[model samples]
Target: MQDKSFSPERQSAFDARFEAQKIAFGPIVFQCVRYAWKRGMLQALAEAGDTGLSVDELAATGRWTPYVLKVVLETCLSAGVVQLRAGRYQLDKTGYCVLSDTITQINLDFVHDVCYVGMHDLDRSLDAGKPLGLQALGPWPTLYEGLSSLPEPAKTSWFAFDHFYSDTSFPAILRDVFSSGARQLMDIGANTGKFSRAALAHDAQVQLHLVDLPQQLAVADITLREAGVRERAHLHPVDMLDPAAPFPAGMDVVWMSQFLSCFSEPVIASILQRAAKALAHDGQVLIMDTFWDRQRYDIAAYCLINTSPYFTAMASGNSKVYESTDYIRLCEEAGLRLVSARDDIGYCHSLLRFAKA
Candidate 1:
């Protein structure tokens, strides 16, 4: 037997290369699905449903070209995203995760339908040092605000994206944030009140204050009633970005998940400062969402697509992901100290947890 040892420098280099490769793999898989879906392969299979459909029928009755359809279908099958049998194709879980009407698929589609459409001008946005894509309405506001002009099916699709992202990780992050025990918590941008329900589930004694758009509060009312938590939940229709004077004093915790990232840096800073005033002496603030990591992944392409001019014509631009360091600095500026920070991977998204100073 031989014992092999590598130098510390060599080991570090190998680990870094492997990490980059893992990150690149996500884009490759996305490209494969995007190419196939653009060519009508995914839709054809979806329309076929459980009954299934053959490539021949897709070209004939389905009106797809035989050669190109076959190439796309075969590629999908090879990727384990679809199944082939007796010349027919059916969706596999991977395919459904990306193509079905489920929340996960809708989230993925939002990237393709809304974000990537502007990727062509990524270089221009990078050079400008400000977002320049179709969604960029101003230096503030998120991509969600611009979808108001979108028609049905597309509008519904964006809601699904919102649901999936909010539900997937916000619950667990809240659990971790309030592990010390929370008696009263406020959820900023609390839509449908589900995140509030998650907290309630974790601790029955905790009272929930749900704040959201006025129209959405109606929806949240129904959700809380159905969940049997209305008795413990208070619905408030107010812009969370507005002044902090309305917030109840002495809150045990403040939860802002997928909320603060929607605003510009100045707004985010102000929001934190206001939130600090509402916290109890020992209360903690929780921020749960994705953050940019220059070392972990290549987000340059994401910045380009998000800031493209194409989106500006259709919707307002989204706030770019800020690094954890920036988030920490914002908290510190508000006179709060970060007691804990943890990063985790969720179903198809990223999770970040922060505890108040």
Candidate 2:
């Protein structure tokens, strides 16, 4: 949970000039480290433990020759992902995380399989305010529409990345969601029905309504049905981006988990306006999402703020992880008032409750 990320306080110890070179050749080093992970060099070093292994010893134990091993190891050594002392190489903390940390593993795969190739067109995506990088996957207008069709490791990695962050947070926040004794709950952006599955199972009396695009609804329908919770669910298929589209009405709670960040500011305002219109007089709208500025740790903030480029080039060009203030102002503009807010929810989420002003 702690990171050795560069801090202003570490200015004396962390050399800015050396860091600049790391940025310059980052793509090569990234791939080399990835190659090391996939090729089992880092794992070998991890298993080698305190004594470590000489380059010759490591080569003797593995298929990689000394030259090839040195190529990967020397780069990692410079990156501080591995260390060399007394002619033996060992996995550094960063290297160990690369091999075993779930978050790091998920993120690495997402970037490599989903974003790496498409990121080349980031300049074009930025200039046009479109997900030009999505072209790398297929000819779908957005990633959501193409998700079901994405091929191979890309498709699997995409779902894994999306689910890892979301699925972990549901159990921790479901209690807060149902504490009001609400029987009607709406899940907007019900990706794969994970939240709906949790909500339906948590409270038997609760009737869950799902609103999403037709394509995603198809996937969620099967998931909910398979989970045996589809009996209490209603599926509403509509694209909220359509200005004329109306939200399903009279809900006790409207949930928009990891949803609003898929839009631009004006589009978010419009969606919130529609959600506000659909709310019962006393209904609350719950938004659970990652706001980069709200993170307590620098590493979380670092990983989050960097996700904007992925949005620009791959997901939705104009939508990036937002700050809480941005959402607060948008909600207020839509005639809603923030009633309750909780932060540091499971897996870097904040739950904000809003009611009609």
Each prediction's whole-model lDDT (CA): 0.65, 0.90
TM-scores across all candidates? 0.65, 0.95
Per-residue lDDT for 342 in model 1?
67
Q: In TM-score terms, which candidate is top?
A: 2
RMSD of each: 8.0, 2.7
lDDT, candidate 1, at 125: 52
Report the poorest 10 consecutive residues by lDDT, candidate 1: 1-10
TM-score computed on alpha carbons, candidate 2: 0.95
User: Candidate 1, 129: how far from true, in Å?
Assistant: 12
Number of backbone clashes in candidate 1: 14
